[model samples]
Target: MSKSILFIELNPGMESTGAKALRICKNMGILTYVVTSDKSFYDSSLGNPLNDAEKVYEHRTDLYHIIDLVEYIKKLNTTHQFRAVTSLSELYVEQAAFISKALGIKNHNYEAIKLARSKYAWRDFLRNKGYAMPKFIFIKDINGLAYVPDEIGFPCVIKPVDGAASVAVSVCDNLNELNVAYEELINYPGFGRGITLNKLAIVEEYLEGDVYSAEYVVYKHESYCLGFTDRIISGYPYFAETGAGFPAKLLNEKKSKFYIESIINIMNFDNCILHIEFIEEKNGDIQIIDLNPRLCGALIAPMIYEATGIDPIKTLIEILIGDEPNLKRTKNRYCESRYVGAQCCGKLIEVKGFQQENLKVG
Candidate 1:
């Protein structure tokens, strides 16, 4: 009998990471049921980009939708008997954990998942572990705005505690600018809609340095530093990431070793895949920005495989499903996926060279 896997996601459909997962599962001889939140997920142009896969399911991106999917999956397990449940989407990580725990399957500890998902929680965890983190406070609201100095003064950053794709992250140089930034964030399209701003926001003393992300594979309580990559983020007041490239030509062996050791020790991570952000200041001090417990969505793993032949996604799944992840660096090929930024000009225009091979267009 073939083993089954349950996947939940909020993306339009199987983008690059999803496609990678699909390919790996097929090769491993495991049956996969790809679950999305809605039919619109498959309706968008990005929905069927791969156009190669034969089996995938689309549901709505909603709580009720996911709950129903879980129920259906549970029923199927009695008949099909799945081996594991996992997710690559940030929003569904905790949900996946809950499902796996309920099913008595292999998964990351729920506490580890929570810490990885929340920026504020992860910062506090690292700080408490004696890891160097920027001075920060979690604010419930603008109440007592005058007391900002008591925590951290001007030149601070305001970002949602649980946010990705660099959404609503702003750097404020002064008091008035901070207020304006907050307002802008509250008014962003997804705010108060997808997630509640009233929950909490983090105010932190901004550290100046070159930003980079360290990608690691933590299997059976051992952390393997596959590689680090330079994160390209737009400058303040808005810090949206544009892309990432692997083999982080910026870091030498010593610097890489220091970051890897620090992350492993501070996070106390066990048997998980992680993506962490760090700032290497001019004085050679390293400060952590945040970390995520899933595969970094910007195709960082594939880029690393392209550049250095180390695939983090494949390795992570193998760990989750009880298979040993291949930790070999196969080839030195630099892979990069650039998001073509477009404005609200109109409907559609001509896109050139997208059909070329070796390019994963989402």
Candidate 2:
């Protein structure tokens, strides 16, 4: 039987885990079909791999938005019979889950993925389950922002319920600041990739502390840890993750792992790869600050492989195709990534790839 798979929102290159998985699939001889935005697929500045992959994958990708992808895939599957349908992009993961169900492919529950997509809904679910989370309230519209619940108080964070990459995330200490954040968040149109915005704002109590991620590769009935990544967070109230180091240099490793797993088991997420980010509070309480259903982004896959020798991207792909994944850690090393950002936001004219020969510690 021929192996085939559907990848949704596969960002062309950018060292993303999705891009890495696409390369792996092509190498494995899987007929790959992608549904992604034109902006990412054709951008050469990010080293567009699709230019070459289009020939190897046995299909030429046309510019298709997320809205038309589902129906189009359904029609195409009549002939292709895709074995797996998945995406690591926040904009399309939920849709991909639904497509998997629609195609009778084994994947996570669509509702679970949906819940994960909306920060407000996810937070509400956690609260109802008696999970320890910071105080929060959901604002349906600009009118709703005026009634900021007193229970949450000031010094809280406000962000789009369906946001990613800290697009409109902000911290507000008073009503004036709250209005500013709400305005900024609500004005942003959509979550990119042509997907509709959730249009809901979530105001959460500010979590003050050190940040780290509890990375896992759940195979079969057991969850495996690839080790935590110590996060270097900056951008003030924006909380942009500027850098990270694998095998987080911290004490009480066992306790933190146990605490994080307990929360994961409760969420009952069925994705093969689980990347949950948490904050070790100033007062010593560990709480899950963000839960991402995909691999840890920011080019974290290389770090995981360098430190643990476990290929998380391949592991996820295997699990999606109903195969057992390898979770063995073959190496004990340290790897870290530091991101460079422009001082002012502007349209990308181009991006220069790093030269390996000239690389040095800053």
Candidate 3:
């Protein structure tokens, strides 16, 4: 019997996880249906990327844009059956949960996703559950900072309650910087004066440390450790991640252990995927930074596969489809990702060299 699966917002075919999913489904002969808002996502990027078995379903539904996706998924369910749904898009994780519940498919709960997406809510949840986290303030009003102590002060980071790719993230040195960051955050892309944006901005004491990310698979209420990666950042004041490399070569071994246990304890996972960020201080104390219930971008999945010979994405998908996945590590190798940085701010011309090297495409 052939299995059916739905993938949401599979874009820019060069995306590692997306490409892997497409390849896997195609190879397994799964009746794959790829969905995205833009029909061009199929034609322009995903076109002929996978084998003929995988089918593309284009709809004008921005899965992350809220209402449209929910309605569209409901509409799609009336006509087609989806056994599982997967995507690397962090923004659509909740919507996927909603759709899964609506269609009676295997997936995490909407409440779980809500807790996963919102930094302020997740922090409070962790603290309430007796888990350790950084000192944080959820800012509903920009003026609320005036009452807070300045020592919690400059060099702190402010970010939206629910955002991805470090978008609208800013590090404030003082009151003036914080104020400017606040204004810029409110006007950020993909956010508006609505329920989504009003959840609150998180102001946290900047935990100084080497940045790293953990990728894991949550199955049967237990989280399986995949591996860790070092985050590469670019820009200033609001340094967004350029890429990631695996395995994380942190100076301290205990710090990596702390990251894994702390993340598992906080996320309360049972059959899911988690991408967590952490900072390791000079004193070797590890602090959790941010958490997402999805895959990290910049080809970290493939990187992890190269490093540990463990594919977290496959395990995640297997769990999503109600299949027991093997979580054991097979082999280990060192892997790194080089960000394709532009020398000058100009239109992207073309890329080369992939055809010659054994480098994994996407």
Candidate 4:
């Protein structure tokens, strides 16, 4: 039987980490298969994720339905032996976990993934475990506004329970600002890609500190800290990320390593890559911001590779298939990614300092 790996969905973007994963698997002589709802996802122009895959199965509807997804995979398994199942998109993390469980493959705990994906649930878990985290409350509706404690008063952050990329994330400095933030996010379209927003939001005390993330991989219950990166965000109101640089200078290696291990022990995460964000106060106290059960999105993987010579996506694939990853550092250098958001949404007409040779537009 030929070895094969299944991807729940290939993320679409110019610098898609999912496409990188597919290429790595193909280079390793493993047959690649992708399950996506849109057949157009295979278009050659969009990084051609399908180019690396041997087969593409279209599950337009019920893609997240575990029973249906499992049935579809089983039917396909009769013809192709699927040795592992995984996903590169945050939207499909839970689905991948469930499918792996159904197939009896090694994977992160489904319950733990669920908790990690939900900000409220993750915060509650940390609080219960005596971890340092910002005070937060779950708001189910407008009526829940009364429950916001005075301590979590003005200058709090409001965001969806399950969200990414800083979409609809905002800060409220007063009651009126809080109301506006609530109204805007409550009606925000495309939350979870039309899956509905869960009608839940989290308002938490804004921790004042420098933001940084620790990227790591867990194999056989052991965690390896790949590296730490500094996160630069747009100041005030809108918390959109401006840039990120690998080998963060502000991170305390010993303290960060201890926190990452504590989180893994509490969540019992296994056989997955974790991107954990945290805040370091002026006094050096560390407080967790969020935990994701997947590779860091955008150009983070590439930046990390460029700086430390470790490919996180490739490491994840090897771990998924029960192989030890080569973690040797081949080089040491600085890598950073910066984005300049458009002031107005429109087509491009002219360009500036971003030369073709020095930078990638997307």
Residue lDDT tens for model 4, 65-171: 56877888888877877888878887787777877777777664788988988989999988888876777888889877766647588678888888766777898
- The collision pairs in model 3 are 154-173, 218-271
Candidate 1, residues 302-353, lDDT tens digits: the string is 6777776767777776787788888887786665556556656786657777
Q: In terms of TM-score, how similar is model 1 to the real structure?
A: 0.85
Quote the positional error of residue 273 for candidate 3 in Å: 1.9
Worst 10 residues of 4 by lDDT: 190-199
| lDDT (Cα) of model 2 | 0.74
User: For residues 226-263, what per-residue lDDT tens digits would candidate 2 score against the true structure?
Assistant: 88889998866677878999988546677777877766
- Provide the global lDDT of candidate 3 against the true structure: 0.70
TM-score of 3: 0.84
Question: Each candidate's lDDT (Cα)?
Answer: 0.70, 0.74, 0.70, 0.80
In model 4, the runs with Cα more than 4 Å from the true position are: 41-48, 60-64, 149-151, 191-194, 354-362
Sorted by lDDT (best first), the order is 4, 2, 1, 3
> Highest lDDT, which number?
4
Candidate 3 residue spans exceeding 4 A from truth: 41-75, 148-151, 191-199, 250-259, 262-266, 348-362
- Deviation in angstroms for 351 in model 4? 2.0
